[model samples]
Target: MPVKLAQSSFRDRTQEFQSVAERLRKSFSSGPGQNGPSSNTSRAEEQRSVVAHQSEFNRRASKIGFGIHQTSQKLSNGQENFSF
Candidate 1:
């Protein structure tokens, strides 16, 4: 016998897997940086700036990808709702 899967089940699993992958990618990508801290004040400021930049980039990229994914999913559903 052939195996079968529900649509919602596949979508939920794939989304969860993708989310975990993204988190791992982000964590590993942010490696150590050079330019040691000159002083506590300056170090703290630099760290904040770095975090802000990374967050902004991640937000923008996620937004774009999410929009595209939504569109593709709608199209894939055959543009019809069949209920019984």
Candidate 2:
């Protein structure tokens, strides 16, 4: 029989975080009454930067989850040689 393992919560948590980050970015970019064009542009850029970093974080989290799943599969299949 194939080994079964519970999925990790890291991806779920990361997705939640990404949602929050997106909201924040939208709020920041849409704020009203900025003093000048430069200020408004800078704030928009900052929001983009934040969202970009969050996306990178989510990608890394997904990769980690994939690795964990692979390891679990190997252990279940009795293919892993090392003991934990």
Which candidate leads the pack in lDDT?
2
- Badly placed stretches (over 4 Å) of model 2 are 1-31, 79-84
Over 1-84, each residue of candidate 1 has an lDDT whose tens digit, in order, gives 998965663234888889999988875676445333455567688999999999999999999999999999998786567554
> What's each prediction's TM-score?
0.45, 0.53
Candidate 2 at residue 61, lDDT? 100
Candidate 1, residue 84: Cα displacement in angstroms equals 24
| Candidate 1, residue 59: how far the Cα is off, in Å | 0.9
Per-residue lDDT of candidate 2, residues 1-84 (tens digit): 998998876544888889999988876787555457887788789999999999999999999999999999988889566578
Alpha carbon lDDT at 42, candidate 1: 79
lDDT of each: 0.79, 0.85
Off by over 4 Å in 1: 1-38, 79-84
Every model: Cα RMSD to truth: 23.2, 23.3
